[model samples]
Target chain A: MTSAASSPIEFYFDFSSPYGYLAARIIDAEAAELGRKVTWRPFLLGAVMKQTKAEPLLTIPIKGDYARHDLARAARYYDIPFVVPPQFPFASIAACRAFYWLNGTDPAKARDFALFLYERAFLAGKDISKPDSVLEAASDAGLDAAAMALALQDPAIKELLKAEVDKAIKKGVFGSPFFLVDGEPFWGHDRIAEVREWLRKGGW
Target chain B: MTSAASSPIEFYFDFSSPYGYLAARIIDAEAAELGRKVTWRPFLLGAVMKQTKAEPLLTIPIKGDYARHDLARAARYYDIPFVVPPQFPFASIAACRAFYWLNGTDPAKARDFALFLYERAFLAGKDISKPDSVLEAASDAGLDAAAMALALQDPAIKELLKAEVDKAIKKGVFGSPFFLVDGEPFWGHDRIAEVREWLRKGGW
Candidate 1:
């Protein structure tokens, strides 16, 4: 296992996950406090679910109701603006492809673009599933809209995202807002406190 | 919705769940702080999972590994002892039936019996899935062994437990360690903080 002090925390998430958005909001700051760098990894949750045969959270029986309430309550807990987009559980293929395209060139700028897209879809209540909206969010985040539009359709860029999703599945990341701190995996945004403690104590 | 002050905090759980054991360790104390009562309702997780088509946490791919780690980590966080039994995802129908039998006669004693059974299974690393083990745990909890032995086979006692499981499903409980505070559902041991906050602020 890599030492916590030397390794960058790997944060795997999907654009369409509310919990993923919540984790994206605070993970950088949380890692910064421990003098750790976080690598923002955007993958497709739908692909992971397909492999796991897991149903969408909103489609499950009792869990669906609790998840809906918890998603909004979690937003309130974090004091972040949130509204469920009308077209939720919508396809995030375009948003994810755009992220990988930008991340390949400028990782920091890609992270900014990710936050921008998350805000548009979750906070501002926009349908980021649309390529046009994704391009708009990309442009707002200071990426060239024309370049992003082209990259979104690039077969190579699409393959990169697919490869990342495959890698994530191999790493046993079956859910969004998953974090790997020096090979230790933590799932869910609620586990941030435990993650912090893990980083602090290395391992218990 | 029932008032938080008057309504008992309903803790729904399956005896075989490690998370349920962890929650059982602290829920009463947490509720006591708010001058609230806790109704320890032990239901079969297998029943809920059947209705939701939800696989046991330990049966899922990546989630299973994380759950094993989290169960132990959560125990350490709460300063409680935990040991995963060799036969995990073990049947808890016997334990549940035993609980209802005792709960029908003495609710307080039933809670004690539940805890005793949990300690035997989780902390002591014993198999309480067997009727003999359930009866032994009940005897250890200061209950009459003969009565419990007879009650364990009673059709009326068996039906009572089944009825509780049905009621839990109808009430939208799809997981162990589920909490209902004034009719608001909170799932997982991780949500205990939210449960406490909800009790304190009476819902936000």
Candidate 2:
């Protein structure tokens, strides 16, 4: 194993995840404040859930109902604006491909693009499940939409995300908004406080 | 609907749940600070999971490993010493019965009994899954040992716990450390901060 200090804090998330969007809004700033850097990796949670036979949050019996209400309360707790999309938990493959494509050259812009897509789907109640819709939003946000559209269909980009998901699963990330400071895993948006403690105290 | 202010916070937990025990360690003091009362209800989460076809935390694939590390980290985060007993996730029926019996007479003493039993199993790493062990813990904690043994076998006490499980399921309580403020549901120990906000702001 390599020295843990060299490993940057990695954030694995899905675009369609409301809590993931909530975490994206603040995690970058939190890391900066803690004098650390974070790498954003968008992975397919549905793919991982499928292997585990796990149901989506909205489909769980009572937990689903609580999550729906908790999302709003948690959003308020973080002082962030959030509105569920018309088609929630939509296929985020297109968004993931776009992020990976942009991330190839401009990682910061990819992050900005990721935030914009999250805002479009969550903040403005837009559906980003389809390629055309994703492209439209990216274009409006002043991104290279044509390249993103091409990247969405690229088989290489498809494999890239597949590999990332495989690696994330290997790292034992089964939930969204999951953070890894070195090899230490922290799951959920709620663990951000605990994440801060880990950063300050350097693991407990 | 009843007056929201009049309805006290309810905490539903199982003695076998580590997260439940962790939350139990603090929910009381937090409620006191908010000038509110909390009721502790111990029900069988196993019963709830049976109907839902949900796997236990340690049984899930990647989530299981993450939960293992998260438990120790969470325990440290809460500043509570927790040790998973020899047989983790053992039946909490005896503990539930003991709690219900004590709750019928002295509610405060019932809470004390609950904490003592939690500490016994989690801190001392003792198995309280059996009636004998639970009775021993209660007796050692200055509770009525002889009477509690009889109560543990009482047909009425058995029915009481069954009814509590059924009623908890009806209230959409499916997880350990599940909290309800007035009629609003908050699941998980992580949501305690949100619970405090809920109590202070009165449904925001």
Candidate 3:
């Protein structure tokens, strides 16, 4: 619980979930207020899903219904816009690879892309599976659409994402937006505020 | 969502936790009023721990602190007696096996034993790992202490307990007092009310 030499908070997220998007948006402000650094560790949620042999959020009958309820309540609580995606379970592989490439060039730009994609998927019901939709999100993030398209095709980006996903799974992370502060796992978006409170108290 | 085919909400619990004791004392009353049968399924919390590689409740630094705060608040909220146990991480294996054996003969007695053990372990600060303490709890449940002692020697009880643990893991159970009504797993004693509400809605 020492205050000195605190490790940066790592946020693991994906573009497919609106909750991840919402968490990513608020995490930086929350960490900054607590005098902590946030490391936006972008990993493929799809990869983690495949590795864990867990059903997708939308597939779990009770949780799926709860997710809808959660979004409505969360949006009202946070004063954010939320619209249900018509064609959910959007293919996030391309968008995730783009994030891997963005991790090298500009982390802020990558975060912006994530936020933009999240807004489109959950706010406007945009079809994120379409390459055009992904390209548009990159453009909104202030990245060159052509450059992002090229980076999305790069084998290195795929490899990096695969490695990150493997590492997360090995660390016993079974869900998204898992915030690791000083080696302690604070799981789920619901735990974000609590993690900040812990950081403020200089507790790991 | 059919009311006619409503199955009794099955609650799987271990007697080691104060939360389980609280739930055991009140759950039957809640279910009975709703015209739903409450099935008590006792399994070794230790066995579930081994399968999931979960640490003891006292070992989880953050959760340990939270439990102390949460349990007291819960006790007061539910108006239940809850004194923290002096020797936690007590072996719930024997208690679990006793329930497994009694499920064949008398589930009502098994439920009573579970409630008695929770009260003794948490309220009385008793070391439930001791053979005499367990025998006393079983005796309090209106069972013959001699027969309960002999049943503890049966290898079949151990196998039955292990199978329950195995079945729990297979069903994606990761915590104690898991309620499965119509195949939906609602975890923790805190979730008992939610289970009742879900059952009332006649949906799994």
lDDT of the candidates, in the order given: 0.88, 0.88, 0.72
lDDT of 2 by residue, A1-204 (tens): 646654567999999999999999999888887767779999999988976678888768877877888899889878899998878669998889888988989999998999999999889999888899889989999988888888998999888888888999999988999999877888999888878888788877
Runs in model 1 deviating more than 4 A are: A1-3, A140-142, B1-3
**Fnat per candidate:** 0.50, 0.60, 0.00
**Ranking 2 against 3 by DockQ, winner:** 2
- Higher-ranked by TM-score: 1 or 2: 1
Off by over 4 Å in 3: A1-6, B1-115, B118-136, B140-204
Residue B204 lDDT in candidate 1: 79
In order of listing, the candidates' clash counts read 0, 0, 0
> What DockQ does candidate 1 score?
0.58
**Candidate that scores best on TM-score:** 1
Give, for candidate 1 chain A, the lowest lDDT window spanning 10 residues.
Answer: A134-143
> What tens-digit string does per-residue lDDT give for candidate 2 at B1-204?
646686678999989898999998999898888877889999999999886668888778889888888888889877899898889879899999999999889989988999899999899999899999988898789888899999999999999999999999999999999998888888889889878877777766
User: Sorted by TM-score, highest first, which candidate order results?
Assistant: 1, 2, 3
lDDT of 1 at A168: 93
